[model samples]
Target: MISLPLLSHAISSCNGPCRDLNDCDGQLICINGKCNDDPDVGTHICGKNPPPPPSGGRGSGCSQYGTLTCGGSAYPTYKCSPPVTSSTAAKLTNNDFSEGGDGGGPSSCDGKYHSNSERIVALSTGWFANSSRCGKMIKITAKNGRSVMAKVVDECDSMQGCDAEHAYQPPCKNNIVDGSDAVWSALGLDKNVGIVGVTWSMA
Candidate 1:
């Protein structure tokens, strides 16, 4: 958070809105004679915060069912409407990431986007391993004044339209993308296949 200027010398200093002031306006509480309000993170109203209700897709965006690895991260750019056929027609307990994974034994969240250093430093050492990125749930927007909630745990590699089998799941299942479907469906992608600006707050 940046500091706002104060009207230290403005008590009886500058006559009016004369000069010396950069972009101050109105009567906010000026500092050093300048005024300011606050900075906005990124606001967008989407559909639902918990999204499709909590029963569906809670941590899929966290890290592929629940691993906390980059393998589960998704940065969707949803469509203006619902998905198409062969599109994401299923919910959580039935998605790709929901499939059995490696020897991880299933965690509650699948890594979405990450703040690696946060988790890595907290690790004890040889317990499991240190994976970069640590995704947390974030609120985003879609249609109208709706807010969609999604997760971001790991760093994505920018690869779309492909599938990666789970190396340890026997039928080895996990978040494997055949196209942008999973990503698109999960985040309710925008018209363009790109990333959306979501305001994240831990739930």
Candidate 2:
């Protein structure tokens, strides 16, 4: 049961933090455990939150943490910090679909995988570790002045040369922004092999 004071608080504080659905009042919804003022009415869930962390479930650490690989599967199973909304300069590249790199057959964000689609992108472990940014939207701008908005769908494996944050060591030769075939075409790059200097930002 909801009390008068609780209901008043919930109604007046629709955008405030919450622990459960009941914390929100009226049409407002509890999302990512927080009450959202402008939630996706269709889904009744805060549209900002990701689709939950990798198969291992949510983590409680920093976004720079790495993942674990077991039994031929890779899981970004580290405690994650809050997602960062700041934009960063990233080196974009295309991933060959020869292997199940689209987040291991299914997208880590929405659990849907489209091999030939270009609306999806894979971020490095450092970026993906911030679970909040998983399903968040990102704007990518190519050097050619073409820009596209993409959703973060998968985590680019550091072992496969996705580590690009090394300051002194010069990263694994790539920051590895793995985009879908459509992304490559949108950036006007050849899908066979290409690199583009791009900037990305999250809202």
Candidate 3:
């Protein structure tokens, strides 16, 4: 496992608001006006410092989990309420990222090749559209309480999706994430579609 060294400054140092990505530390980015750490191999997959619980979802249930608070009030522009903690609220799908008739073939955002052993995810176009999220890390917690940290390796597009301007189609609704076989196994999910309550956050 790879271990990441700590930043000279704590993550909270940059928690203050910022308007530009350049305003935050080189390893951090500005999201929602706050400087935050860019989830990486050390914090997520390396078993070093794990992130907090879900706090950015639907009800107060979200706050009990991660650092970010969830709820309609927490996110003014959010599309839908975040699911309750460990509830089967988020829907999970699967994809092979295979070549040929699989349509888009290899990863559309980055050309990097990810084998099944890698814990990778094909995020919805809405999220994948931001190329900056390409190599970052995301923490995915399943309803069963099994969680895994995965890399943003590819894009998950539905009908009329995966364009340079946009990453998904309207039909993708609710299904914002599609994991590789390795991801499915890591979360203790079955090979088929898994209706899981997922809580994720950047490291």
Give model 1's TM-score versus the native structure.
0.21
The number of the candidate with the highest lDDT is 2
Cα lDDT of candidate 1 equals: 0.27
All predictions: root-mean-square deviation over Cα? Answer: 19.5, 15.1, 14.5
State the C-alpha lDDT per candidate: 0.27, 0.54, 0.52
TM-score, one value per model:
0.21, 0.47, 0.48
Superposition error at 59 for model 2 (Å):
27
lDDT of 1 by residue, 79-181 (tens): 1112222222221111222234321222223533222122211111111123222344334333333444444332222111123322222221222211122
Q: How should the candidates be ordered by TM-score, best one leading?
A: 3, 2, 1
lDDT digits (tens) for residues 1-203 of candidate 2: 75433443453244666666556543345667566643332322334543443343334223322233234444332222234445566778775332445234455566565665657687765677644468777888787788888777776644222222211121222245677777778777777656677777774
Tens digits of per-residue lDDT for model 3, 73-165: 121111222342332344566656544313245776567455666787776544555566787888888878888988887665432232222
Model 1 scores worst on lDDT over the 10 consecutive residues at 120-129
Which sequence of candidate numbers ranks them by lDDT, best first? 2, 3, 1
Candidate number with greatest TM-score: 3
Candidate 2 residue pairs in backbone clash: 60-79, 61-79, 61-80
Q: Give each model's clash number.
A: 44, 3, 15
